[model samples]
Target: MTVIEIDGLSKNYGADKAVDGVCLRVEQGEIFGIAGPNGAGKTTVVECASGLRRRDGGNLRVLGLDPQNDRRRLLQRIGVQLQEASLPGAIKVGEALRMYASFYDKPADWRELMDEWGLTDKRRAGFASLSGGWKQRLFIALALVGNPEVVFLDELTTGLDPSARRTTWGLIRNMRERGVTIVMVTHFMDEAAALCDRIAIIDRGRVAAEGSPRELIAKGRADSLEDAFLVLTGGETA
Candidate 1:
């Protein structure tokens, strides 16, 4: 089943086209990746699908309903972890989890999630005192608190150490096993290659390519996903 459908979607900021004629579909339980260089309109396309940004053209549907028109209902069924999320300077980890749980009609057990994310030791720590990896883990826990059907993660592992990145990858795979669909946006080609069932590569406000990591690399006659992406986008040293 298709959980998301975007057809000829376009978004513009004044004279600049952020997303242009982009089309893609995500299956019900797949880990879908959107990859591109900076300013490739990846974020804009995600925002449009998540109903955070309205498109200037084309159509978008999440679970068979218009994301813009059915935003309230859609939001209840989906979770989002934006690139730049912030919390109160003094908010404790436990308190932050509780606050997020209160927003959903049926939230997962905060303690369980804390343990799953290895956050029990820092439950009483202030949000400001947490390290980058801890903060990312907290965000992941918060995104899953609602037991959402679809989750959107933008640049999920940007500033993490290798160990933390691998740990987060395991958590993401576990989420898929529990039947949650994921839409991830990242600049890291290896992350997409390792996690995504299918990937859409965007360039200059358009989809430059779409396929499994292996398929894309095969098409480019390249040995790696990053090389394929560079070839397609005409990047230097690609």
Candidate 2:
């Protein structure tokens, strides 16, 4: 099943083309990575696909629904973790989770999610008091609280330490096992290499390349995903 489809998608800021004529398909129950240097339109593509931004051209569908025209219905079936997210400074972790849970028709137990993400001990902690990694974990919990079929994780492990990053990666794999389709936007080559079943490298508002990490490396004649990324995006990998 194709969970997401985009063809000739375009978005612009003034005269600048942020995303231009990009096409891609994401299958069900797969981890799809969108990677590129900053301002390469990677985020713009997802923002458009998720209905956070309106596209200027082309067609897009999420679960066979037009994200722009069917936003309310589509939102119920998908969750998005933006590149940057925050809660009110005074909101406690548990409070935040509960609030997010209320948005969906059917929600997972926030308490269970807190325990699963190791946020149980920090339930009473204010959002402001939590460290970067803990905050990320909480955001992830919020994203999944709705029990969405498709989840967008953008820069999910950006500020986490190595240990926390690994733990989060494990959680992502577990999510895939449970049949959730994921569209991840990340700059971490190692993260993409380890987690993504397929990757699309966007550059200058276009898709520079798309393939598995190994295939990309082989095609680029590089030693690793990192080197392949560098080669594909013309030395820009963010």
Candidate 3:
């Protein structure tokens, strides 16, 4: 089943195009990735799909529902963790989780989520006091708190240390195991290569290549995903 479908999707910032004629599809229960260098329109595409931004031209569907026309219903079924997410400095970890969980009609237990995400020990810790990795974990927990069928994670592990990044990879795999579909926007080549079942490489507001990591490497005649990305995007891959 296709959970997301986009065709000729385009977005612009005045005269400059951020996303241009992009076409992509995401199937059910797979971790799909959108990889590119900064300013490559990777974020713009997902933002449009998530209904955070409007597209200039094209058709987009999330679970067969129009994102712009059916935003209210779509928001209820999808969870989003933006690239730069934040919370009130004084809010405790548990408090933040509880507050977000309350917004959903059928939310997961916030207490259990804290424990699952290794935030139980820091439940009372203020949001501002948490480290980058901890903050990332909390954001992920909050995104999943609503038990959404589809989850969008943008630059999810950007600031995490190596250990935390790998831990998050495991968590994402767990989410997929439980039948959730994932769409991630990331610049980390190794991260996307390791986690994404398939990926679309966007560059300069267009899709430069689309395939599995191995396929992309072969197409670019490179030994690794990073090198392949660099080759395809003319050294523009992040």
Candidate 4:
């Protein structure tokens, strides 16, 4: 069940090559990670695959459909949670969920989602007042409102404290357990190792190496995934 397929994918910004001849395959019900240092084009890869951005060269398919050609049809079947997930400061939790649900032809009940994500009590709370952790919970809730088969989570736990990060990881695992395919983009090697079934390390706009965390460590002959990433990327920031 290969849900996503890419071969020689490329994207560019002006004269700069943001993604260069990248290839990947993501299967059903797996947590696939795209990890890389800053400016390595990790986000661009997902954006292109998920139909957020158009590619300059090569081919990609998401859920057996061409992302660019079938964007409208694709959007209905996939959910995306971006790193900069944000809403108006005055928007309440319930309001936000309701708004997102309206975007889908067939959506999950936002109220049920609120309760399931522990935001029922905060339904009246304003977006500006919610803590970082609570905001993330809401973001995940919003992503699920469409009841999508595949979800793209980009840098999902980037700024959270340890506790919040762990909680977010639990939420991600819960998504996987429910048989949803996940494509995660992050720079944290430990997070990738902890949650991802397989990872592709992007460096300088190309896939430098890709495998399970342990397999990558074995390939680099390093002590850990982080060390292997550092070795693979020539000490670039993880």
lDDT of each: 0.91, 0.93, 0.91, 0.91
Query: 112-141, model 2: which lDDT tens digit per residue?
Result: 998999999999999999988889999999
Location of the lowest summed lDDT over 10 successive residues in candidate 1:
229-238
RMSD of 3: 1.6
Give candidate 4's error at residue 108 in angstroms. 1.9
lDDT by residue (1-238, candidate 4, tens digit) is 9999999999999999999999999999999999888999988888898898999999999999999999999999999987776899999999999999999999999999898888999999999999987898889889899998899988878767798788778988988999999999988888999999999999999999999999999988898999998898898544
TM-score for each of the candidates: 0.96, 0.97, 0.96, 0.94
TM-score of 1: 0.96
lDDT of 4: 0.91
State which candidate has the highest TM-score.
2
- Looking at candidate 3, the ten consecutive residues that score lowest on lDDT are 229-238
Clashing pairs in 4: none
Q: After superposition, how far is residue 76 of candidate 4 from its true place, in Å?
A: 0.6
- For model 4, what is the error of residue 12's alpha carbon versus the real structure, in angstroms, after optimal superposition? 0.9
TM-score of 3: 0.96
lDDT of 3 by residue, 209-237 (tens): 99999999999899899999899889955
Error of 3 at 25 (Å): 0.5
